[model samples]
Target: MTPTHAARLVRELSQPLVSGAFLAARDRERLLEVLPSATGETLDAFAAAAVAVRRARIGDAASLCAIVSAKSGRCGENCAFCAQSGHYATNAPQHPLLPPERIVAAAAAMARRGVTRFGVVASGKALPDAELESVATALAGIAALPMAADASLGVLSEDALARLKAAGLAAYHHNLETSRAFYPSICTSRTFEDNLEVLRACRRSGIPVCSGGLFGMGETWADRADLALTLLEAGVFSVPVNFLSPIAGTPLANRPVLSRDEARRIVVLLRFLLPDRHIRICGGRPTVFGRDASLAPMAAGADGLMVGDYLTTSGGMPDADRQGLRRLGFVVAQAG
Candidate 1:
């Protein structure tokens, strides 16, 4: 498309949101240009329109998941966006794996608070063998509860994933993090394909893959497009849209938080690209989306949310989350 086509393109993309049909991949560029880059009421209004599209396609019941930090700090990889990287002096907590009972208690608490999904997120490239076994044992207990269990234990071998699946792991949480072209700039410790291999291993173990990326880390609009396409290529059933929450000691510590409009546009793009996929707004919402953080993201076609604490950061309260969703006319999924 020519430069002159941008204005008309934005109108084309905006029309579908009102018409109750999702924008197709062919129209991604036009969709990207729909909202102004500046943060203002215009951006807010554009995002508000997506609420109808989200409701029409995905309904009012939103899936909420809580994550407990099973292990903390001392990561070997140098992912610039992470506070947990050992290469950085972020002073993020360092702790060994939680005992099986403590992990089980965390999941139980989430289940009691209407969370249907629970995740155990750890720092580092992979868990040690003993910690893996202990975590697997915890999963067995978590499975018996009312919630589905997931883990972000970093890269793992096929055999390791098989053991996790055997331990009642319903899904594997892995974020591709960003596009292939921009990945190396963010981390030299591992290739983007290394993350993909882990996803394939999870699939081989009969576990569904929940994959996504953290945006607003100096990536361009094109990079964002590539991230969406990569997640679709991975055949992920769910996508966690994370906005960068820069930590003071990391490489990207000085990066500004994403404009609320920019964050919402990221979700809108993913929803348009994968209309039926479970689009979830994950880490960094509180700092990124301003006061109406929760409502704006859901309005942008995200059907799931990471409702509790993150791997190294705090999250919004689950009680406030439920009440906010109710006020907005959306139902929190009762734990199954």
Candidate 2:
């Protein structure tokens, strides 16, 4: 499309979004055209429209969630992009399941920094049976913290979910990672069905699920849209959109970083797709957007921010996140 045509398309198509009505079949078709352009004035216009949609649907406040790497490394999964997968010689030192005191301390730290929803995420296909008691003990401590608690302890059994929910866990996080069609290329140790069942189990156990996927993994745009549609169908409330943060010694280590505009467009696309849901810009925000990433995300239709470090990597500091939120005229929503 010509630049003029692109401009008209964005201006005309983005109008219905301001009413907070979801994209109709035709709107989705037009946005599929508007979102994939790697370079354009249209993308900026689309992003602004997305932000308007975000404000109208979810309001201007950003929800914050902090995560602790409660357990790390020695994951049996062969997710090629992960630093903690045991399939690669990444030199990631294994850390045992943290004691309750340390787990509580991390929650408290982020709570003090104005965070409300905190998660304890470990690396593995599932928590070891031997570690469940310790993890339960940690959840007890996390429960007492002045924040909401969530956990991602791998493909947890119902018993484990019960244990966690009893100990004050209100949410469960298990990323679908990508489209089911793209799952084989991302990991062989686990199927997309495996994760889906686990998420279903969490919901059955009465815990809300926070599921999302990584982008920039050499997948097609169709893969990205398919993943989003799947998550929406699954009733996932929180969509933590993670960009691939490649680690050295991992299979995808040398993968090129995604363009900042593409990253922003992904956020815009998701906001357009899931207008009322939490479209969180998680983990790799710093890697994909080196400067102005914090505000860029909020400006471009994201209302959820994962503050603090990630499971195997550092992220934008909590203080910086706070400043950016304030600069962009966002108030931190109180954590439930």
Candidate 3:
């Protein structure tokens, strides 16, 4: 398209009347036209537009989600990007699944801190029936809490998914990690389709799926865009954009980290594309944006955030996150 046409398209996108098709395509020429003109004022304009979009779809209310590393380390698959998998010699804490009491206590603590969604994450390819039963038992203890329960137990069987759903699991998280074309380069032990199957299993069991990708792991911009579009196609209810942390002893340890501006740019671009989905700022937030930079994401259309500490890493405290949201004039929404 000509420069004039591109400029016109960008203006059209900025307006609320544009069709969904235009946003879905997210034409590069249109983005370039507007991005070049994005001064501080334009950035705020974009942010305001994103907030309006988010409020219309999911409301101005933000949700705080927390996760517990129930089962840590000794993972079989060698996903070159992960720090917790046993395949990498990183000093990630390794232990069997925490006892049910500990899991229940963690859930209760998160509730006390105003977190409405509780997630349990395990590191491995998939869980056996015994392991699934263990997770189900943990979910049962916290059934009384108003918080919504979710799990990230790797690839799951039909029976496992059913049992978790029956135990009141509300959502399931299985990251695509990256685009299918680039997935093999990062993980050798598992296929991209294996992850897709797990998401499909979640859907089959009538649970909402929360799937997303990690950025800055030696992927091209096209790769990042492809990952976003893939998640859109997969019907993911929540998208957690995690930047690569490059932990010591991992294959990507020497890789350069992403700047906070670049991370925010991706979040803004994702808002333009997935205008109605829950876009969360997940792992690597503290290291990338610093603790003070939390509200920049909420201003850029992020509707949810992972609260408390992340797996094997310390994030900001829950009270601090709540304060940040309040300072920005955002009200934390309780999970239904």
Return the top candidate by lDDT.
2
Q: Best-fitting candidate, measured by TM-score?
A: 2
> What lDDT tens digits, residue by residue, belong to model 1 across residues 60-141?
8888888889888888999998888899898788998889899999999989889988988888898877678899989998
TM-score for candidate 2, residues paired by index? 0.94
Which should have the higher lDDT, number 1 or number 2? 2
Write candidate 2's Cα lDDT for 202-315 as tens digits: 878888999999999898887888888888888899999899988899889988988888888888888878888899888888888875655687788899889888877778
TM-score of each: 0.90, 0.94, 0.91
RMSD of each: 3.2, 2.0, 3.0
lDDT of each: 0.81, 0.84, 0.79
Candidate 3 wrongly placed segments (more than 4 Å): 1-11, 16-29, 32-44, 333-336
| Local accuracy of candidate 3 as per-residue lDDT tens digits, 197-238 | 887877777889999988888887667777878888888999
- The parts of candidate 2 lying over 4 Å away from their true place are 2-4, 333-336
Query: Which regions of candidate 1 fall more than 4 Å away from where they truly are?
Result: 1-25, 36-49, 334-336
In angstroms, give how far residue 220 of model 1 lies from its true place.
Answer: 0.5
Ranking by lDDT: 2, 1, 3
Q: Positional deviation of 308 in candidate 2, in angstroms?
A: 1.6
